[model samples]
Target: MIDIVLLSLLVVIAIAIIRMKDLFAVVMLTGIYGLLSASFFVAMDAVDVAFTEAAVGAGISTLLMLVVITMTGRKEKSTRHKPLSALFVVMLTGGLLIYGTLDMPYFGSADAPIHKHTSPRYINDSMEEIGIPNIVTSVLASYRAFDTFGEVVVIFTAGIGVLTLLCVARSQKNDEEIDSINDSMHQQHLVIRIVAKMLIPFIFLFALYVQFHGDFGPGGGFQAGVIFASAIILYAMLFGLSTARKVINQTFVQVIAALGVLLYGSVGIVSLMNGGNFLDYNVLSSNPIAGQHLGILLIEWGVGCTVASVMVVIFFNFAGRRAFQQHKKQAQDKESSAC
Candidate 1:
């Protein structure tokens, strides 16, 4: 019953997002949708997935969308042309998805291929093989380590792509103009600043707890990384981007992001050197179980580093561009006033 309610709310939110002309409200509604999805995941007993959806989807993605809407206008422009082709495409895709679902096995069917094949091994053998109580952690960190590595690489590539496209060269402006622009961008919400400063330490602590406790609990690197990034983003919002940049510069972020991928690859390479296949953690230590534990820890750390750095880098680039544009507009206004 709760799931049905949440799903209905999600549908309503989706429709509202589509119909809303205000981009800011649409972004807020999208966050609401993410929260609802996370709630649904929790109800389905997928707590790890819920954690990720809440942190990344509802938290970081919403913040990014807000930044984007600030750069572009808040109001979506009206268009006269009908989106007939787009509507047709959407309808066709929806129909195909519904058709595909017809052939799928019922949820939790005993005859399902997943239950018959790898699921039994992961459930029964994971503790003996990987020495991890959490089968999800064992599967993600050991059974599918290569796939996780590829995901990390994809995130790194995406961050690089965004930086390449949006990290434009700053216009040559005098110190006075730059300082004035920075001053203007600085937020003056004293209450927010106090609350954020108080919460930031606890947030970082929780992120660390999530990062290290994944083997026993429903949290892991991906979720932890987004939580950490959210703290930084909140700091940037309350304090100012310049101050945040001073704390962790863009150059350092880029280097850390690269290092994370290198660290994951290095673990695999080391495993290969130890007479094992790539990502085979059994060879990392004298005790195979110990080796497995070590490998999972290292890989999870690498994933967290890459994800956190990439998120911060993307945010910095967007904030920088916004500042530059605002400065240019202010300069133009000043010139017009002089004329």
Candidate 2:
């Protein structure tokens, strides 16, 4: 019953987002959509997925979208193009998806091939094989370790792509323009600042706990990274981008992001050097179980570093561009007034 209500809310939010002309409203609706989806995940007993959705979708992604809208303007331009083609494409895709589902096993069916085959092995043998009681962690960090490495690489590549598109080379600007932008960026709410200052340390401590506690529970590197990034983002919002940049500059972030991918790959290389296949954790130590633990820990740390740095770098680039555009607009206004 609750799942149905959440799904219905999600559908309504999606339609509202489509109909809304205000970009700000659309961004807010999107956050609402993420929250509803996270709730649905919770109803389905996927707490880890719900955690991710809440953090990335509802929190970080919404913040980024809001930042982008600041520069692009709050109102969407009217489109002259007809929607018939788009409607057709959506309907066609939906029909195909429904058709594909016709061949799938009934929900939670014991006879489902996935349940009959691979699920049993992971559930039955993960403890002895991977030395982790958490089946999901064991499968993701051990059995499917290569795929996780690929995911990290993909995230690293995405961060590089965002930088390529948004980051500008050093250009000369007058001190007045710099000062104007800096002055405008500072938040005036002392209460918010004080509260955030008190919370940031606890947020980081929780991130570390999630990173190291994944072997035994529902938290992991991805969640930890996003949580950590959120703390930095909050600081940037409350204090100023300049302050955040001073704490961890874009160049440093880029370096850390790349290093994370390299670190994960290096673990694989070490495994190979120790006479095991790539990403085989057994060779990391004489005790196979200990090696598995060590390998998962290192890889998870690499993942956390890459994800946190990439998110922060992306946020910085967006915020920086917005500031630049605002400053340019202000200068143009001043010149026109002088003329």
Candidate 3:
């Protein structure tokens, strides 16, 4: 019953998103949709996925979208092109996707191929093999460590791509007042600022707990990283970007991001040197279980570091770009008024 209701709400949100014209409202609705999706994940007992959806989808993604809207504009532009062809393509794709699922086993079927195959090993043997209480952590950080390494690399690459596109040159005139989108916000939201300052330290503490406590619980590096970045983002929102920059050096963040990837890769190389296959944790220590524990811990930390730094870097670049454009516009307005 809960599943049905959540699915229905998801469908409604999807339709609303398609129909909505106000980009700001659309972004807000999108965040709500993410929250609902995360709730659905929780109902399904996938708490780790729920945490990620809530943090990345509902929180970080929404902020990035809002920042982007500052440069793009508040309202969506009306297009002159007809939608008939696009509609036809979408219908075709949807039909094909539904068709593709026809031969799949029903949800929660114990006899499903996945359950009969990999799930059994993960469920029954993972504890003995990996010595981790959490099977998801065992699978992701141990059995699938290579895949996780690739995921970390992908995140680092995305940060590099954003940096390339949105890199803003620092202004030479340190004393000149720069107009910022957050200036009015910081001044107007005194209560929010006070409450956020109080909450920020607790948020950081929770992020650290999530980062290190994954072996026995629902959270791991990815969720923890986003949660950590979010606290800094909140600070920047309340205190202004310049102050946040002083607190967190952009160059140091970039370095940390790179080092994280290196750390993950280094574990694999060390395993190889120890006469084990790449990412084989068994070779790290005489006791296989201890090696697994050590390897998982290191890689998870690497993932956390990379993810947190990348998220912050992306936010900083987007916010900085928006500030630059605003400053340029203000300067142009002043010049025109003088003329």
Best by lDDT: 3
Q: Name the regions of candidate 2 deviating beyond 4 angstroms.
A: 170-181, 184-187
lDDT of 1 by residue, 188-270 (tens): 57777888899999999999999999999998888888899889999887667776777887899899999989999999999
| Model number with the top TM-score | 3
**All candidates in order of lDDT, best leading:** 3, 1, 2
- C-alpha TM-scores of all predictions: 0.94, 0.94, 0.96
Give the higher-TM-score candidate: 1 or 3.
3
Candidate 3 residues lying further than 4 Å off, grouped into runs, are: 172-176, 179-185
Clashing pairs in 2: none
Clashes of 1: 0
Q: Candidate 1 at 143: error in angstroms?
A: 0.6
Tell how far residue 214 is off in model 3, in angstroms.
0.2
Candidate 2 per-residue lDDT over residues 175-252, each given as its tens digit: 346545666655458787898899999999999998889889888889999999999999888777766777877798
lDDT of 2: 0.88
Question: Candidate 3 residues 1-339, lDDT tens each?
Answer: 797899899999999999899999999999999999999999988999999999988999999999999899988788899899999999999999999999999987778887787888899999899998889899999999999999999999999999999998887552135524457657888999899999999999999999889999999999999999999999987888887998999999999999999999999999999999999999999999999999999999999999999999999999888878878888899999999
Alpha-carbon error at 57 in model 3, in Å? 0.8
